[model samples]
Target: MSPRLVLVGPPGAGKSSVGRRLARHLGVELRDTDADIERTAGKSITDIFIDDGEPAFRELERAAVAAALAEHEGVLALGGGAVGHAETRAALRGHTVVFLDVGLADAVGRVGLNRDRPLLLDSPRAQLKRLLDERRPLYEEVASVTVVTTGRSIDEVVQEVILHV
Candidate 1:
Protein backbone atom coordinates (compact mmCIF):
# COMPACT_ATOMS: atom_id res chain seq x y z
CA MET A 1 0.00 0.00 0.00
CA SER A 2 1.10 3.55 -0.59
CA PRO A 3 2.01 5.10 2.73
CA ARG A 4 -0.47 7.37 4.38
CA LEU A 5 1.29 10.07 6.36
CA VAL A 6 -0.07 12.60 8.82
CA LEU A 7 1.96 15.70 9.64
CA VAL A 8 1.38 17.24 13.04
CA GLY A 9 3.00 20.23 14.65
CA PRO A 10 2.48 23.61 16.21
CA PRO A 11 1.38 26.39 13.91
CA GLY A 12 4.07 27.69 11.55
CA ALA A 13 6.02 24.47 11.97
CA GLY A 14 6.01 23.89 8.20
CA LYS A 15 3.25 21.28 8.00
CA SER A 16 1.35 22.85 5.12
CA SER A 17 4.42 23.81 3.12
CA VAL A 18 6.21 20.54 3.76
CA GLY A 19 3.10 18.49 3.25
CA ARG A 20 2.46 20.03 -0.14
CA ARG A 21 6.01 19.42 -1.28
CA LEU A 22 6.19 15.95 0.23
CA ALA A 23 2.94 14.97 -1.41
CA ARG A 24 4.25 16.23 -4.69
CA HIS A 25 7.40 14.20 -4.29
CA LEU A 26 5.45 11.09 -3.32
CA GLY A 27 2.85 11.59 -6.07
CA VAL A 28 -0.05 11.74 -3.61
CA GLU A 29 -2.68 14.34 -2.97
CA LEU A 30 -2.32 16.63 0.01
CA ARG A 31 -5.25 17.17 2.28
CA ASP A 32 -4.99 19.98 4.80
CA THR A 33 -7.36 19.40 7.74
CA ASP A 34 -7.62 23.09 8.55
CA ALA A 35 -8.81 23.80 5.02
CA ASP A 36 -11.21 20.90 5.30
CA ILE A 37 -12.61 22.38 8.52
CA GLU A 38 -13.02 25.76 6.95
CA ARG A 39 -14.91 24.31 3.99
CA THR A 40 -17.11 22.12 6.14
CA ALA A 41 -17.99 25.02 8.40
CA GLY A 42 -18.99 27.05 5.31
CA LYS A 43 -16.88 29.96 6.50
CA SER A 44 -13.28 30.87 6.94
CA ILE A 45 -11.64 29.61 10.15
CA THR A 46 -10.90 33.14 11.33
CA ASP A 47 -14.52 34.03 10.79
CA ILE A 48 -15.64 31.01 12.75
CA PHE A 49 -13.40 31.98 15.63
CA ILE A 50 -14.81 35.51 15.58
CA ASP A 51 -18.46 34.42 15.47
CA ASP A 52 -18.52 31.15 17.38
CA GLY A 53 -16.46 30.30 20.45
CA GLU A 54 -13.21 28.33 20.50
CA PRO A 55 -15.06 25.26 21.68
CA ALA A 56 -17.29 25.39 18.65
CA PHE A 57 -14.32 25.87 16.38
CA ARG A 58 -12.62 22.88 17.98
CA GLU A 59 -15.68 20.76 17.46
CA LEU A 60 -15.58 21.66 13.80
CA GLU A 61 -11.86 20.93 13.61
CA ARG A 62 -12.30 17.59 15.32
CA ALA A 63 -14.96 16.60 12.86
CA ALA A 64 -12.82 17.58 9.91
CA VAL A 65 -9.75 15.76 11.24
CA ALA A 66 -11.73 12.61 11.88
CA ALA A 67 -13.26 12.70 8.44
CA ALA A 68 -9.96 13.28 6.72
CA LEU A 69 -8.32 10.43 8.57
CA ALA A 70 -11.12 8.07 7.78
CA GLU A 71 -11.36 8.88 4.10
CA HIS A 72 -8.00 10.11 2.88
CA GLU A 73 -5.08 7.80 2.24
CA GLY A 74 -2.64 10.46 1.11
CA VAL A 75 -0.68 13.09 3.01
CA LEU A 76 -2.56 15.22 5.55
CA ALA A 77 -1.56 18.35 7.43
CA LEU A 78 -3.48 18.83 10.66
CA GLY A 79 -3.86 22.11 12.46
CA GLY A 80 -1.46 22.56 15.34
CA GLY A 81 -4.05 22.01 18.05
CA ALA A 82 -5.67 18.93 16.53
CA VAL A 83 -3.91 16.54 18.85
CA GLY A 84 -4.93 18.38 22.01
CA HIS A 85 -8.37 16.83 21.75
CA ALA A 86 -8.42 13.35 23.25
CA GLU A 87 -10.66 11.79 20.64
CA THR A 88 -8.50 13.14 17.84
CA ARG A 89 -5.31 11.99 19.52
CA ALA A 90 -6.75 8.54 20.06
CA ALA A 91 -7.67 8.26 16.41
CA LEU A 92 -4.03 8.59 15.43
CA ARG A 93 -3.16 5.17 16.80
CA GLY A 94 -1.41 2.96 14.22
CA HIS A 95 -1.14 5.85 11.78
CA THR A 96 2.27 7.18 10.86
CA VAL A 97 2.44 10.64 12.44
CA VAL A 98 5.40 12.93 11.85
CA PHE A 99 5.86 15.74 14.34
CA LEU A 100 7.58 18.71 12.73
CA ASP A 101 9.11 20.01 15.93
CA VAL A 102 10.11 23.65 15.56
CA GLY A 103 11.29 25.62 18.56
CA LEU A 104 9.28 28.49 20.05
CA ALA A 105 11.52 31.15 18.57
CA ASP A 106 11.51 29.66 15.11
CA ALA A 107 7.79 29.15 15.29
CA VAL A 108 7.22 32.75 16.35
CA GLY A 109 9.48 33.89 13.56
CA ARG A 110 7.54 31.80 11.09
CA VAL A 111 4.18 32.91 12.44
CA GLY A 112 5.13 36.49 13.27
CA LEU A 113 2.51 37.61 15.79
CA ASN A 114 -0.25 36.59 13.41
CA ARG A 115 -3.46 37.17 15.33
CA ASP A 116 -5.35 35.04 12.80
CA ARG A 117 -4.28 32.00 14.75
CA PRO A 118 -7.22 31.55 17.06
CA LEU A 119 -5.32 30.19 20.03
CA LEU A 120 -2.41 32.58 19.79
CA LEU A 121 -4.54 35.68 19.70
CA ASP A 122 -3.10 38.39 21.95
CA SER A 123 -0.67 35.87 23.48
CA PRO A 124 2.99 36.74 23.67
CA ARG A 125 5.97 34.53 22.96
CA ALA A 126 5.79 33.12 26.48
CA GLN A 127 2.22 32.12 25.85
CA LEU A 128 3.27 30.35 22.67
CA LYS A 129 5.86 28.39 24.62
CA ARG A 130 3.28 27.57 27.26
CA LEU A 131 0.90 26.28 24.63
CA LEU A 132 3.64 24.20 23.06
CA ASP A 133 4.65 22.86 26.45
CA GLU A 134 1.07 21.87 27.11
CA ARG A 135 0.67 20.12 23.77
CA ARG A 136 4.18 18.72 23.45
CA PRO A 137 3.37 15.62 25.45
CA LEU A 138 0.31 14.86 23.36
CA TYR A 139 2.25 15.31 20.12
CA GLU A 140 4.95 13.02 21.46
CA GLU A 141 2.38 10.47 22.50
CA VAL A 142 0.97 10.06 18.99
CA ALA A 143 3.94 10.80 16.80
CA SER A 144 5.55 7.81 15.14
CA VAL A 145 8.52 10.05 14.47
CA THR A 146 9.63 13.58 15.34
CA VAL A 147 11.64 15.77 12.96
CA VAL A 148 13.02 19.07 14.20
CA THR A 149 12.57 21.81 11.63
CA THR A 150 14.49 24.63 13.28
CA GLY A 151 17.21 26.18 11.17
CA ARG A 152 16.24 23.82 8.38
CA SER A 153 15.04 24.64 4.92
CA ILE A 154 11.74 23.30 3.63
CA ASP A 155 13.61 20.84 1.40
CA GLU A 156 15.61 19.60 4.36
CA VAL A 157 12.46 19.08 6.41
CA VAL A 158 10.72 17.32 3.55
CA GLN A 159 13.73 15.09 2.98
CA GLU A 160 13.72 14.15 6.66
CA VAL A 161 10.02 13.30 6.58
CA ILE A 162 10.45 11.39 3.33
CA LEU A 163 13.21 9.28 4.81
CA HIS A 164 11.43 8.77 8.13
CA VAL A 165 7.93 8.22 6.87
Candidate 2:
Protein backbone atom coordinates (compact mmCIF):
# COMPACT_ATOMS: atom_id res chain seq x y z
CA MET A 1 0.00 0.00 0.00
CA SER A 2 1.06 3.58 -0.60
CA PRO A 3 0.57 6.68 1.51
CA ARG A 4 -3.04 7.59 2.20
CA LEU A 5 -2.18 11.26 2.41
CA VAL A 6 0.94 13.32 1.79
CA LEU A 7 1.51 16.76 3.33
CA VAL A 8 3.45 19.69 1.87
CA GLY A 9 3.84 23.25 2.99
CA PRO A 10 6.13 25.91 4.42
CA PRO A 11 7.84 25.66 7.78
CA GLY A 12 5.60 26.00 10.87
CA ALA A 13 2.60 25.34 8.70
CA GLY A 14 1.83 22.49 11.08
CA LYS A 15 2.55 19.72 8.57
CA SER A 16 4.24 17.57 11.19
CA SER A 17 1.75 18.26 13.96
CA VAL A 18 -1.29 17.99 11.75
CA GLY A 19 0.11 14.96 9.96
CA ARG A 20 0.57 13.19 13.30
CA ARG A 21 -3.03 13.79 14.30
CA LEU A 22 -4.32 12.92 10.88
CA ALA A 23 -2.38 9.68 10.88
CA ARG A 24 -3.76 8.80 14.32
CA HIS A 25 -7.26 9.54 13.16
CA LEU A 26 -6.83 7.38 10.10
CA GLY A 27 -5.21 4.60 12.11
CA VAL A 28 -1.96 4.88 10.18
CA GLU A 29 1.61 5.80 10.97
CA LEU A 30 3.18 9.12 10.04
CA ARG A 31 6.24 9.05 7.81
CA ASP A 32 8.10 12.35 7.76
CA THR A 33 10.71 12.76 5.06
CA ASP A 34 12.72 15.23 7.11
CA ALA A 35 13.06 12.81 10.00
CA ASP A 36 13.87 9.98 7.66
CA ILE A 37 16.57 12.08 5.99
CA GLU A 38 18.09 12.94 9.35
CA ARG A 39 18.06 9.29 10.36
CA THR A 40 19.63 8.19 7.11
CA ALA A 41 22.37 10.82 7.28
CA GLY A 42 22.98 10.16 10.97
CA LYS A 43 22.79 13.91 11.41
CA SER A 44 20.33 16.69 11.90
CA ILE A 45 19.06 18.69 8.91
CA THR A 46 20.90 21.80 10.13
CA ASP A 47 24.17 19.93 10.23
CA ILE A 48 23.58 18.45 6.82
CA PHE A 49 22.92 21.87 5.32
CA ILE A 50 25.92 23.50 7.00
CA ASP A 51 28.32 20.67 6.28
CA ASP A 52 27.10 19.32 2.96
CA GLY A 53 25.13 22.27 1.56
CA GLU A 54 21.53 22.61 0.37
CA PRO A 55 22.04 20.62 -2.81
CA ALA A 56 23.27 17.61 -0.88
CA PHE A 57 20.42 17.86 1.62
CA ARG A 58 17.93 18.07 -1.23
CA GLU A 59 19.32 14.86 -2.63
CA LEU A 60 18.71 13.13 0.68
CA GLU A 61 15.23 14.65 0.87
CA ARG A 62 14.39 13.51 -2.62
CA ALA A 63 15.46 9.98 -1.82
CA ALA A 64 13.55 9.89 1.43
CA VAL A 65 10.38 11.22 -0.16
CA ALA A 66 10.61 8.68 -2.94
CA ALA A 67 11.07 5.84 -0.50
CA ALA A 68 8.19 7.01 1.68
CA LEU A 69 5.88 7.36 -1.29
CA ALA A 70 6.75 3.83 -2.34
CA GLU A 71 6.84 2.06 1.01
CA HIS A 72 4.81 3.91 3.63
CA GLU A 73 1.16 3.08 3.76
CA GLY A 74 0.37 5.96 6.01
CA VAL A 75 0.35 9.76 6.25
CA LEU A 76 3.50 11.44 4.94
CA ALA A 77 4.79 14.90 5.74
CA LEU A 78 7.60 16.47 3.71
CA GLY A 79 10.01 19.18 4.67
CA GLY A 80 9.02 22.73 3.70
CA GLY A 81 11.38 23.03 0.79
CA ALA A 82 10.83 19.58 -0.64
CA VAL A 83 8.45 20.82 -3.31
CA GLY A 84 11.09 23.17 -4.72
CA HIS A 85 12.80 20.28 -6.45
CA ALA A 86 11.25 19.39 -9.79
CA GLU A 87 11.69 15.68 -9.23
CA THR A 88 9.92 15.76 -5.90
CA ARG A 89 6.91 17.52 -7.42
CA ALA A 90 6.79 14.95 -10.18
CA ALA A 91 6.86 12.13 -7.68
CA LEU A 92 3.79 13.59 -5.92
CA ARG A 93 1.60 13.45 -9.00
CA GLY A 94 -0.37 10.29 -8.17
CA HIS A 95 -0.68 10.82 -4.44
CA THR A 96 -3.17 12.69 -2.31
CA VAL A 97 -1.05 15.69 -1.51
CA VAL A 98 -2.30 18.20 1.04
CA PHE A 99 -0.89 21.70 1.32
CA LEU A 100 -1.13 23.25 4.76
CA ASP A 101 -0.91 27.02 4.38
CA VAL A 102 0.11 29.33 7.18
CA GLY A 103 0.68 33.06 7.27
CA LEU A 104 3.99 34.59 8.35
CA ALA A 105 2.83 35.70 11.78
CA ASP A 106 1.40 32.35 12.74
CA ALA A 107 4.50 30.61 11.43
CA VAL A 108 6.84 32.75 13.49
CA GLY A 109 4.77 32.18 16.58
CA ARG A 110 4.73 28.47 16.14
CA VAL A 111 8.33 27.82 15.12
CA GLY A 112 9.98 30.72 16.95
CA LEU A 113 12.27 30.79 13.89
CA ASN A 114 14.58 28.75 16.04
CA ARG A 115 18.29 28.17 15.70
CA ASP A 116 17.80 24.50 14.99
CA ARG A 117 16.25 25.37 11.65
CA PRO A 118 19.21 25.75 9.32
CA LEU A 119 17.57 27.95 6.74
CA LEU A 120 16.36 30.47 9.27
CA LEU A 121 19.81 31.23 10.63
CA ASP A 122 19.67 34.96 9.89
CA SER A 123 16.74 37.41 9.77
CA PRO A 124 14.16 34.70 10.20
CA ARG A 125 11.11 36.69 9.22
CA ALA A 126 12.64 37.84 5.98
CA GLN A 127 13.95 34.40 5.21
CA LEU A 128 10.62 32.78 5.99
CA LYS A 129 8.78 35.27 3.80
CA ARG A 130 11.11 34.54 0.92
CA LEU A 131 10.69 30.82 1.38
CA LEU A 132 6.94 31.08 1.46
CA ASP A 133 6.88 33.17 -1.67
CA GLU A 134 9.18 30.84 -3.56
CA ARG A 135 7.55 27.60 -2.41
CA ARG A 136 3.85 28.46 -2.27
CA PRO A 137 3.54 28.06 -6.01
CA LEU A 138 5.21 24.68 -5.86
CA TYR A 139 2.92 23.58 -3.05
CA GLU A 140 -0.09 24.69 -5.03
CA GLU A 141 1.19 22.93 -8.09
CA VAL A 142 1.33 19.57 -6.31
CA ALA A 143 -1.49 19.74 -3.79
CA SER A 144 -4.62 17.70 -4.24
CA VAL A 145 -6.20 19.83 -1.52
CA THR A 146 -5.09 23.05 0.14
CA VAL A 147 -5.86 23.65 3.80
CA VAL A 148 -5.34 27.04 5.36
CA THR A 149 -3.99 26.55 8.87
CA THR A 150 -3.69 30.01 10.31
CA GLY A 151 -5.31 30.32 13.76
CA ARG A 152 -6.91 26.89 13.53
CA SER A 153 -6.68 24.14 16.09
CA ILE A 154 -5.16 20.76 15.29
CA ASP A 155 -8.52 19.05 15.58
CA GLU A 156 -10.03 21.52 13.15
CA VAL A 157 -7.31 20.89 10.61
CA VAL A 158 -7.64 17.14 11.07
CA GLN A 159 -11.37 17.29 10.59
CA GLU A 160 -10.98 19.27 7.40
CA VAL A 161 -8.40 16.85 6.02
CA ILE A 162 -10.56 13.88 6.96
CA LEU A 163 -13.48 15.35 5.11
CA HIS A 164 -11.36 15.97 2.02
CA VAL A 165 -9.37 12.73 1.97
Candidate 3:
Protein backbone atom coordinates (compact mmCIF):
# COMPACT_ATOMS: atom_id res chain seq x y z
CA MET A 1 0.00 0.00 0.00
CA SER A 2 1.01 3.62 -0.53
CA PRO A 3 0.23 6.75 1.46
CA ARG A 4 -2.32 9.29 0.32
CA LEU A 5 -0.07 12.10 1.46
CA VAL A 6 3.47 12.52 2.79
CA LEU A 7 4.69 15.52 4.79
CA VAL A 8 8.34 16.56 4.93
CA GLY A 9 10.13 19.47 6.57
CA PRO A 10 12.48 20.52 9.36
CA PRO A 11 11.45 20.42 13.01
CA GLY A 12 8.79 22.92 14.13
CA ALA A 13 7.46 23.05 10.59
CA GLY A 14 4.23 21.54 11.98
CA LYS A 15 4.41 18.25 10.07
CA SER A 16 2.97 16.23 12.93
CA SER A 17 0.24 18.68 13.78
CA VAL A 18 -0.64 19.33 10.18
CA GLY A 19 -0.54 15.63 9.35
CA ARG A 20 -3.01 14.80 12.11
CA ARG A 21 -5.52 17.40 11.01
CA LEU A 22 -5.05 16.61 7.35
CA ALA A 23 -5.58 12.92 8.00
CA ARG A 24 -8.77 13.64 9.92
CA HIS A 25 -10.00 15.98 7.24
CA LEU A 26 -9.34 13.32 4.62
CA GLY A 27 -10.86 10.57 6.79
CA VAL A 28 -7.63 8.59 6.95
CA GLU A 29 -5.06 7.63 9.54
CA LEU A 30 -1.80 9.49 10.18
CA ARG A 31 1.46 7.61 10.50
CA ASP A 32 4.50 9.51 11.68
CA THR A 33 7.84 7.81 11.04
CA ASP A 34 9.46 9.39 14.09
CA ALA A 35 6.85 7.85 16.37
CA ASP A 36 7.20 4.58 14.53
CA ILE A 37 10.96 4.59 15.06
CA GLU A 38 10.54 5.33 18.75
CA ARG A 39 8.07 2.48 19.10
CA THR A 40 10.27 0.02 17.27
CA ALA A 41 13.34 1.05 19.23
CA GLY A 42 11.44 0.86 22.50
CA LYS A 43 13.05 4.14 23.52
CA SER A 44 12.81 7.84 22.92
CA ILE A 45 14.60 9.49 20.00
CA THR A 46 16.86 11.39 22.36
CA ASP A 47 17.88 8.18 24.08
CA ILE A 48 18.61 6.58 20.75
CA PHE A 49 20.78 9.51 19.82
CA ILE A 50 22.52 9.41 23.17
CA ASP A 51 23.15 5.68 23.07
CA ASP A 52 23.46 4.65 19.45
CA GLY A 53 24.44 8.05 17.99
CA GLU A 54 23.11 10.19 15.12
CA PRO A 55 24.19 7.82 12.35
CA ALA A 56 22.47 4.94 14.10
CA PHE A 57 19.35 6.95 14.76
CA ARG A 58 19.31 8.01 11.14
CA GLU A 59 19.56 4.40 10.01
CA LEU A 60 16.54 3.49 12.10
CA GLU A 61 14.70 6.53 10.79
CA ARG A 62 15.45 5.54 7.20
CA ALA A 63 14.12 2.07 7.76
CA ALA A 64 11.03 3.33 9.53
CA VAL A 65 10.32 5.80 6.72
CA ALA A 66 10.75 3.12 4.06
CA ALA A 67 8.45 0.75 5.89
CA ALA A 68 5.80 3.41 6.43
CA LEU A 69 5.96 4.50 2.81
CA ALA A 70 5.56 0.94 1.64
CA GLU A 71 2.91 -0.20 4.10
CA HIS A 72 0.86 2.81 5.05
CA GLU A 73 -2.22 3.74 3.05
CA GLY A 74 -2.94 6.84 5.07
CA VAL A 75 -1.19 10.16 5.60
CA LEU A 76 2.51 9.85 6.44
CA ALA A 77 4.60 12.45 8.20
CA LEU A 78 8.34 11.86 7.96
CA GLY A 79 11.11 12.73 10.36
CA GLY A 80 12.73 16.07 9.46
CA GLY A 81 15.94 14.42 8.30
CA ALA A 82 14.34 11.61 6.36
CA VAL A 83 14.87 13.46 3.13
CA GLY A 84 18.60 13.37 3.75
CA HIS A 85 18.61 9.69 2.96
CA ALA A 86 19.10 9.05 -0.74
CA GLU A 87 17.04 5.89 -0.72
CA THR A 88 14.15 7.57 1.03
CA ARG A 89 14.20 10.44 -1.46
CA ALA A 90 14.20 7.99 -4.37
CA ALA A 91 11.33 6.09 -2.81
CA LEU A 92 9.26 9.27 -2.55
CA ARG A 93 9.39 9.84 -6.31
CA GLY A 94 5.74 9.04 -7.03
CA HIS A 95 4.04 9.94 -3.80
CA THR A 96 2.34 13.25 -3.09
CA VAL A 97 4.97 14.78 -0.81
CA VAL A 98 4.31 18.20 0.68
CA PHE A 99 7.21 20.33 1.92
CA LEU A 100 6.05 22.32 4.96
CA ASP A 101 8.40 25.26 4.69
CA VAL A 102 8.83 27.36 7.84
CA GLY A 103 11.20 30.21 8.39
CA LEU A 104 13.93 30.13 11.04
CA ALA A 105 12.24 32.57 13.42
CA ASP A 106 8.93 30.72 13.39
CA ALA A 107 10.64 27.37 13.76
CA VAL A 108 12.73 28.55 16.69
CA GLY A 109 9.64 29.97 18.36
CA ARG A 110 7.59 26.84 17.84
CA VAL A 111 10.24 24.49 19.19
CA GLY A 112 11.72 26.78 21.82
CA LEU A 113 13.79 25.18 24.56
CA ASN A 114 12.30 21.75 23.90
CA ARG A 115 14.82 19.28 25.27
CA ASP A 116 13.14 16.44 23.46
CA ARG A 117 14.92 17.53 20.32
CA PRO A 118 18.44 16.20 20.59
CA LEU A 119 19.70 18.15 17.61
CA LEU A 120 18.59 21.43 19.11
CA LEU A 121 19.93 20.87 22.61
CA ASP A 122 22.86 23.24 22.03
CA SER A 123 22.17 26.73 20.72
CA PRO A 124 18.78 25.87 19.31
CA ARG A 125 18.37 28.96 17.22
CA ALA A 126 21.66 28.60 15.34
CA GLN A 127 21.34 24.84 15.05
CA LEU A 128 17.81 25.12 13.71
CA LYS A 129 18.92 27.72 11.22
CA ARG A 130 21.67 25.44 9.94
CA LEU A 131 19.28 22.51 9.72
CA LEU A 132 16.72 24.49 7.77
CA ASP A 133 19.36 25.74 5.40
CA GLU A 134 20.93 22.35 4.86
CA ARG A 135 17.67 20.45 4.50
CA ARG A 136 15.62 22.86 2.43
CA PRO A 137 16.92 21.57 -0.89
CA LEU A 138 16.38 17.96 0.06
CA TYR A 139 12.81 18.74 1.10
CA GLU A 140 12.20 20.59 -2.12
CA GLU A 141 13.72 17.82 -4.21
CA VAL A 142 11.18 15.23 -3.08
CA ALA A 143 8.15 17.39 -2.59
CA SER A 144 5.41 17.67 -5.17
CA VAL A 145 4.08 20.79 -3.52
CA THR A 146 5.36 23.32 -1.01
CA VAL A 147 3.34 24.97 1.76
CA VAL A 148 4.79 27.89 3.69
CA THR A 149 3.72 27.53 7.30
CA THR A 150 5.50 30.52 8.78
CA GLY A 151 3.07 32.88 10.53
CA ARG A 152 0.10 30.82 9.41
CA SER A 153 -2.36 29.00 11.64
CA ILE A 154 -2.61 25.22 11.64
CA ASP A 155 -6.02 25.42 10.03
CA GLU A 156 -4.67 27.56 7.22
CA VAL A 157 -1.75 25.20 6.66
CA VAL A 158 -4.07 22.21 6.67
CA GLN A 159 -6.35 23.86 4.16
CA GLU A 160 -3.44 24.67 1.87
CA VAL A 161 -2.22 21.09 2.06
CA ILE A 162 -5.72 19.84 1.29
CA LEU A 163 -5.80 21.80 -1.92
CA HIS A 164 -2.71 20.00 -3.24
CA VAL A 165 -3.74 16.55 -2.07
Best-performing candidate as measured by TM-score:
3
The global C-alpha lDDT for each of the candidates, from Candidate 1 onward, is 0.89, 0.93, 0.95
Lowest summed lDDT window (length 10), candidate 1: 118-127
127 in model 3: Cα distance from truth in Å?
0.2
Clashing pairs in 1: none
Q: Tens digits of per-residue lDDT for model 3 on 25-142?
A: 9999999999999999999999999999999999999999989988999999998999999999999999999999999999999999999899999999999999999999999999
Residue 135's lDDT in candidate 1: 87
Cα shift from native, residue 20, model 1 (Å): 0.6
Global lDDT of model 1: 0.89
Rank candidates, TM-score, best first.
3, 2, 1
TM-score of 3: 0.99
Candidate 3 vs. truth: CA RMSD?
A: 0.5
65: Cα error in model 2, Å: 0.5
TM-score (C-alpha, index-matched) for candidate 2: 0.98
* Two-way TM-score contest, 1 vs 2, winner: 2
Measured on C-alpha atoms, candidate 2 has an lDDT of 0.93
lDDT tens per residue, model 1, 57-146:
999989988888888989999999999899999899889999999998999999887867867777657778988899899899999999
Off by over 4 Å in 3: none
* Tens-digit lDDT string for candidate 2 (66-117): 8999999999999999998899899999899999999999998888859878
Lowest-lDDT window of 10 residues in candidate 2?
108-117
Q: TM-score for each prediction? A: 0.95, 0.98, 0.99
